[model samples]
Target chain A: MTGDGVLAQALRYLNDPLSWTAPGGILDLTGQHLVMSVLAALLAAAVALPLGAWLGHAGRGAAVVVALSNTSRALPTLAVILLLATAGLFGDTATVLAAALFAVPVLLVGAYEGVRGADPAARDAARGLGMPGGRVLWQVELPLAVPLLAAGVRTAVVQVVATVPLAALAGGGGLGHVIAFGMGTQRYGQVLAGGLLVAALCLVVDGLLALAQRFAVPRPLRARAAATAAR
Target chain B: MPGNPWFSLEWVRANADVLATRSWQHLLLTLEAVAIAAAVAVPLALLVGRRRRAAGAVVGTASVLYTVPSLALFAVLAPLLGIGRTPVLVGLVVYALLVILRQTLAGLQSVDPAALDAARGLGYGPAQVTLRVQLPAALPAVVSGLRLATVTTVALVTVGVVVGYGGLGQLMFEGFRNNFHRAEITTATLACLLMALVLDTLLWAAGRAATPWLRGRADGGRRAGHGQPARASVRAGTGTDLGADGRGEAA
Candidate 1:
């Protein structure tokens, strides 16, 4: 019997009805991946957004933000996940927390930079209008900073999705299971299918977020940019 | 009580040989991957930087390549390469490409346009202007990019344990498999982080030392002190060309 190429094997696996509808099928795996990634992103944002924004508003902690982000780049997410999972936490929880930590530095950096880079004239004007400092931050700075904040979140989400497969190593379920199982059993096609699925998910999410960012940007800013280009 | 397994001196003493071997393997693997990445990225960045129009496409491609999941890349490569050092090395090289490529392009374009004009005025040829004027000015950004890429690659080497590469990740996997042996996990984690930090600091120092001219310009002939060079403020654009403005403070 002739062996199929990886591409051919992947197509066969993907085309099989059982692969989609059977227990722990492709659709199920996709759902697991999405849930795990979104959970991680939300968790990261919950922690990073407040601290970053507060720091930006107060004009303090830039050093801390820089230090945290730099140190984070030097730490491996999978190792953290492994350490946590081995400590008897639920595999998924460990993976989510680890991924959240990985996601934080980017989100925090984005929030801080965006707010810090907000238009000083606008900020002063808001203050001149007798707005409280907190009000100015929430009402003026954050709205103007939406584009950058969205970009950060978008990047973090895509990364978290991609990293979620590491969880499969600790017995947490995701598309990584398909890849790992294929590797163990020499099912090259299953591996390909899993990889293709992940890539497709990343592209789709990124495209959607790009579209969202376009809409998320303040309408006035977009019009001004367009008008400037026209001139 | 057996004390904290993670901090166990006995466990570390027992596994000293393996730990030392794996750390060396990890360092070598990271160096090889970064070297290959820099070689490819530099030429490609120079080509793309010259065109300006190709900047978007080049950066976009690298970003997309980077977004390919690490394990997924390994899985895809394993079918053809059979899960060993080759696949791991290739995966890491691709991973490092975006950061290095983006940095190089940014560095090349960061040269002051006035400087380029001055070089041309002095009868310098295109190649001479690029090498003498542009590259020298772009040094800080490029070196900064290289430093970031090296650190990132070092951390990522730990992921190669899945593909059977014996980096520090091998220790991580071993510790993981043996019911989370504390000493093993803690030691591997510390070693990996330390390597990344030490390598980053060394690269940072090397960058500073290599660009004495930048410091001279920043200091305006004042004896250099511990303060960072003013050129350090130039934001290395990852995709967008900051152009003349990026070097605004460099002067």
Candidate 2:
């Protein structure tokens, strides 16, 4: 219970290779966390699209979506999982829903803003070129909005990946099992070790995104400005 | 749908004291975490913003922290700290780093580099330049980041229920646990929503107040014509500090 005891024990757990080599260890979590994280990002992006993009583009009654997103933002993942899980949904569905909800408001805000903030002049020019509204949205608007979409997806990835550990609480499983076990046993070393491991996972995912994110950046951002200048 | 447990104003009114007490406790928890988060994040952000490579590394670290699952983080912390405010506060501080670092970087980066050179030419040392020029220029972004942190912390602090700290989350979780439909669930849910709205508005106002030069009265036309000051640009569903640069134009 003392800080010294806890710190020493925690370090011991982290340093012990046997813990990992043992039957159920960090490796068990890798697959599910990966699945849940990606699923969370995809679910957040998908939900925010029509709901966020339409609201962003439509230009009226938009506050409703904003309000809803904000409201979702208010509800914590614990509250949502507890509520939904109690209603009979469990495991992956519960984790995904919790992660998706955690992600939605922020994702929607990005989607909405990215769409609304799309260069008006660019849209006008695309329309002038005879692009239909749908074509304009798909070709011009979405292209320009890709960065924002990517940005939202990136946010969801981090949020979902980090938070999926929460699934363990409801028996959904992930690094959360490590975390919850550590807590339940009053094993401070195990808790910090679990936390540190989860935190490391977050860093790896973020690093992967930094590289992957460039693909989502708008084409204009990618074009060498000097090359275009020379042209 | 038929039961509609949360719709009765009279029922909620009867428990106004309980609801209000929980709201205040929730608010206090949020404010405490935010205050601590700002203390650590702002200073660190200023320091990192000076070096490009370092900033990237720091930002990378923040992303990892920002996305941490609250349930697990708290669960991990709770056993060591053994429940209640301390562990939760620590988590919020970590969460704030994710936003604060990225936003602070954005604000600092956005400053016309020319301005810094001018300050240097005027004989400002690195310290003077940072305190006077860099910090001021970055203030708007800093405040915006703070706002995002505030909104986010307010939302997540509700998870403090996992540790049995007992705030509005207690009501929300209890409602969920007992299947106490409308009265408990309804009351807690509405309180959370209202608190979120109120906290968001307060943070938005705080951002504008902090950065008057950015939201100059002339920009009143911008507000009237466009929308509210694009404070934090948090894309609700996603967990990235992406808004830091997403609508750089809007910010």
Candidate 3:
């Protein structure tokens, strides 16, 4: 603790009250980061969820879903942000749009796989019980697909949160502003502190979503998942 | 036409040399990172083979590393390594580790138990069984992991711009800094996307070539039952289907 190592300095920087309550303090930046990430995720889910679910239910376009998921992984967030921002979009709008575009493939693939992987037996039972096709999809398939769908959302949210930092490079607001500022000034301690903050945020968000994923599944499905894990 | 257009053939024609250099750098950096990651991850996976506690610990630590943003990781490393390709390379390798390690372990675990038994019955030693029997069988999954890692590395190499080593990302950054040079940004971005797709197709073809037996299975009914679930699970984000499928086959 006495040594003036980079880690020690970073720890000191994080501990100071000034870092938390300054004009663009950690708290302020964190709020910006979360807002952008959440908005982008919601935007992505609105489009991806319904489309993926409908496609999965219809048992169509599985190949396209797989292809999109693979291709999206290769689309750099930095490139996307730069493209949109330079294409005449406003800074915050560009950031949100890029993040939403990055999140879509994961959500789409998740919803598609979730609904497609639903138990055929349950669907058959619902059909036999005089449920219409639409009712069977609503009552049987969607519920069964909840776990995987939540998992996808969890992954997408974490990824978007992680990538939001790149928005700073494009003149947008976020915790990335802290890192970008540190980099500009060659302040290693501040840079490390910013990195730590972003990493911590990502882990916390991921952990919360992981818990949500666990709880979102129907009780019976949760029990079955637990049983499978136990086995 | 009302300011600079999104794309311009003249700009691309003039900057062709710069574009090629950046594209090559991007490709080289991606290949190096993934190759190094595969080298490290495969050995680590083999060392931790079949050990549940060790595998859990290793993968848990890796997933934590994986969750850190690329820019943040580069920032943290820049202090230690000094701004350059080394830190970016190290960061890229770290990001690739979780995907590659998980895939390798999953692949090794997916090897048929009967194959191992057969190797042993023929007086094969443990090392021999691992090398001669298991490795070949797990090749498909390992290649699959490599494909994921490679694609991820290609995307991530752009973040290296934080340390001034972001390959095509540097061009994208430059475009933004230079009053939003539309053609420059569009060209670089498209190049990144094109590189990713082309690399993926190449890897997929290589995987197909390396595993000829799977082609035979492709022509059989079991193909639907075997391939679809694994592909679905991978895309769905669980990525645990290789091991699960092996266990199911054994059962």
Q: Best candidate, DockQ-wise? A: 3
Q: Provide the lowest-lDDT 10-residue window in model 2 chain B.
A: B242-251
Model 2 agreement with the true structure over A1-231: per-residue lDDT tens digits: 776777788788777887766667777677777888788778777776777777666644455555555455556666666566755688668888888877776677667766765789998999899988778777777777666666666666776786687676666777777766775676767777777788778777866875676665756755532221111
Model 2 lDDT tens row, B148-227? 66776777777676566647877766666565454675567667767767876776676666666766444332231111
lDDT of 3 by residue, B87-130 (tens): 89999998777777877776776677888888899999988887
Ranking of all predicted structures according to TM-score, beginning with the best and ending with the worst: 3, 1, 2
Which 10 consecutive positions of candidate 3 chain B have the poorest summed lDDT?
Answer: B242-251
Residue A85, model 2: lDDT of: 72
Cα shift from native, residue A116, model 2 (Å): 5.2
Candidate 2 wrong stretches, greater than 4 Å: A2-42, A50-71, A86-88, A109-126, A185-190, A215-231, B1-4, B7-22, B46-57, B79-82, B112-138, B179-182, B203-251
Q: How many residue pairs collide in each prediction?
A: 3, 22, 0
Error of 2 at B215 (Å): 6.3
- Candidate 2 chain A least-lDDT 10 residues: A222-231
Against the true structure, candidate 3 reaches a TM-score of 0.91
Q: Please name the candidate that would achieve the greatest TM-score relative to the true structure.
A: 3
Which candidate number would show the highest lDDT if scored against the true structure?
Answer: 3
